[model samples]
Target: MANTTDDTTLALDAVKGEHPTDIFSLDGEGDWSPHITESNLPTKIIWSPTMGFSTVDKDVLAICEEAISELEKAGVEVVVNDSIWEVNPVESWMVFWACARARAQQHLIGTEEYESIDPLLRLFIEMGVTMDGASYASAIDACHHYNYQLEEAFQESPLIITPATCGQPPKLEGDGFVNGEETASWVDFTMGINMTRNPAGVIPVGNLDNNLPVAIQIIGQQRADLDVLKAMKAFEEVINFRERAEDF
Candidate 1:
């Protein structure tokens, strides 16, 4: 497992400029505080394709509809934003991330080799997935693109809400696979924000039958993640969105 602390340091460097990095920032500043009390809170919200609402499985969809209605019943409003696919294609992000991984591996894999880079690019090209905006060819480029988008989105709202995973949090315990098996690897919707260097925290909404809990991810712009956290704390007091049996 990559040392969590090491990954955090590298991720933070990508955000705050080099050297003299803000201590409060390299550490964390918490969420953005747009308002102080309940009366002043913005009723505005934004949601994107989540646990459901974008497929034709036709089965298990009732579960999704009921879940959405429950959220509304709990006094929380749903804000629909971009589709799940807007974030980036699974292949593109993975391929791009793999290149970054490979570059990080180069020095250790002996003589500055680009061994890992070639295949990912070739696979992406062969699949005919648009590589026009992909940075899979260059590790720096991929990280740069990820960072750029993070800044762009958060710049608008000191906060933005997105599904914690394109799906749900994986069963964290399973036959080990660094990032999990191929089938589960791409569930990391949270990582893009991680790669951006903002402090994001997750709170359990409730559990799914398989026992994995769903979490709503709160993200903040720049150095104001603490405000996001604070808002989440506030949100919990008034809204009780949960599973039918979640008794909370």
Candidate 2:
């Protein structure tokens, strides 16, 4: 995910010359690892000026930056923490669950008919444990661990901000939308926090030459949801996100 969009999806859009780089030869992960500086904060917050910001949800990033500064003034360190996603245990379980669901024509997040409660259809039903029976305790516990980290680290921050999508908006694909688009790509930026039950909201940013939305998702740490949201409200009243992102 060079930025955020899935490699397969990027390659699909690349065929039409809509992507910034040649996607066909992309290896997904040779380099491009996210890293932080001596301050232990990201040296480069991933942003693709070419892809630009979302014309529809641009206020988010500005509000987050503003909130960070305000929080700092009050003696707090506000940062967009780099997700230690590669080492996350829930991620592995999520993959297994996702694959199991896919085999039964079900999807974990994107599809309209997500069989979560009662789980009328799927392997879990055959084994009799859809939402929370017995076998899933391992996976659920792992998810809990993931959330605990968010609770401990992010709960103090006034607000957290992330791109709506890592790269740019995705384009239409061939015969079926499956390969070209997946819910994961669309949610690359903010879903991890969402998974931990953090409060999050997206605001219109700006757009690319292709007229795609490049919104920023604003997240709140745990129960501080209201303050985080209100902070964004304050920042939105003062900042000019579009003017600054003209070259985004």
Candidate 3:
């Protein structure tokens, strides 16, 4: 967890001039405190333990830390706690299977034409081909679980910031696909939003030492899509992110 320190540090340094657009304390709301704003940056960040993985590369953590720190120092409120609920493993698979099934149905009905598709995608279609009643029940359960968690988190804070990806962009292979494990890592920071059906967006903030882009994700409650976009637009004005990129 501490491994993200360096990358996050550099990332903050990269976007030195940005400032907060609005500052408000969540003190009276729930179990969270407004004073977390005064603590060291990471201590103020809230991540879900249910989203655990085997290993997070040092650089991945670094970028994450940097983004959080910069946002905090600029006067945005941050919360360090388990603020969201967890979904069952079966529920997670059911969502994926449902999406795959739709894709397979599209292909079967000849909606579009392509010379070929990725082998993994083909496998996904096959997996979804047999979706049953149990699958539908699991999907509904997952929807409710995610909506509840999102509602709980939003009750504490209006905005949630997270790493856009687990780490830097992957080096695409000749087959145009990374291994299953690596691809999974890339989506670590994102798939939860998909499953939860929340509105989220990615804003490019800085670059890694190797010139790879680093982005921070902004997420909000369901049906608050416009509010989420407005927040990002305000952030864009404060960070003036494109000007920073031009400097690079």
Candidate 4:
């Protein structure tokens, strides 16, 4: 959103309204100040080479590997592990997402209002309404279990790194490509983390052969937003991938 980490902190403070009891809310005075710098690098990081998905593009994976090497050279312990989550949380997350949408748009159903909206969103709402109560409850239980798993991982390493996207950026009209095949689920990497509600940030690592930017995700422990930002800042300094308007 901003050109630098300090700018991001300032922008967040500007909109993070005053909420006394909310633990996630920013504390007024010192909270707005930027604490991340070159010296604030993480001691250890967990690097998930893949999200256990076969659709990840080879080019994206290569860039992530190179980034890992750079991080290792910078004196940070990088643990390479393929198994991060015991069970895929994407399915469970989808249930919650669809159900939430259905609840919000329930009144529009069976009316002209529903038919007038976008077809893809209409399909999502339809899926939500048809879901049984047991299924929704099951999804909730799954998410809780997954959160526990993430908490365990965070105990071993304060941060986890993964490719921000499975493949090259998807075109506005279509899905992304992996190994020359179009894959609709290429963007599933972030949804599972979203379910955990852990703090995550992305930093550009390199550019693909097509000149499209590729990035890696840095996920931090729950309520560790500052730690995530610090790691991002450190990685940003090490990688030093700069962008120019003409490159796009």
Q: Evaluated with TM-score, which candidate comes out highest?
A: 4
Ranking the candidates on lDDT from highest down gives 4, 3, 1, 2
- Candidates' C-alpha lDDT: 0.46, 0.43, 0.54, 0.80
User: What is the per-residue lDDT of model 3 for residues 97-139, given as tens digits with 9 covering 90 to 100?
Assistant: 6566656554653333422655565556666765666776777
TM-score, cand. 1: 0.50
Q: Relative to the unseen true structure, what is the Cα RMSD of model 4? A: 2.5
**Model 1, residue pairs in steric clash:** 30-225, 30-226, 30-227, 31-225, 31-226, 31-227, 31-228, 32-227, 32-228, 47-79
lDDT string, candidate 2, 105-192, tens digits: 5434344545554453454434322444444566666667766765554444445555555444444642211124333334344435
Cα lDDT tens digits for candidate 1, 99-209:
555445444443444354566544434333433333545544555666666565443345556545445333554321212332343345544554556667544454555
Give the alpha carbon lDDT tens digit for every residue of 37-75 in model 4.
877878898888675543578998899889989989989
* Clash totals in order: 10, 11, 6, 0
The weakest ten consecutive residues by lDDT in model 1 span 51-60
Minimum summed lDDT over a 10-residue window in model 3 is located at 25-34
What stretches of model 3 exceed 4 Å from their correct place?
Answer: 1-56, 82-115, 174-181, 238-240, 243-248
Candidate 3's TM-score? 0.63
Poorest 10 consecutive residues of model 4 by lDDT? 25-34
TM-score of each: 0.50, 0.45, 0.63, 0.89
Q: For residue 198, give model 2's deviation from the true position in Å.
A: 1.3
lDDT of 2 at 245: 34
Q: After superposition, how far is residue 95 of candidate 4 from its true place, in Å?
A: 1.1
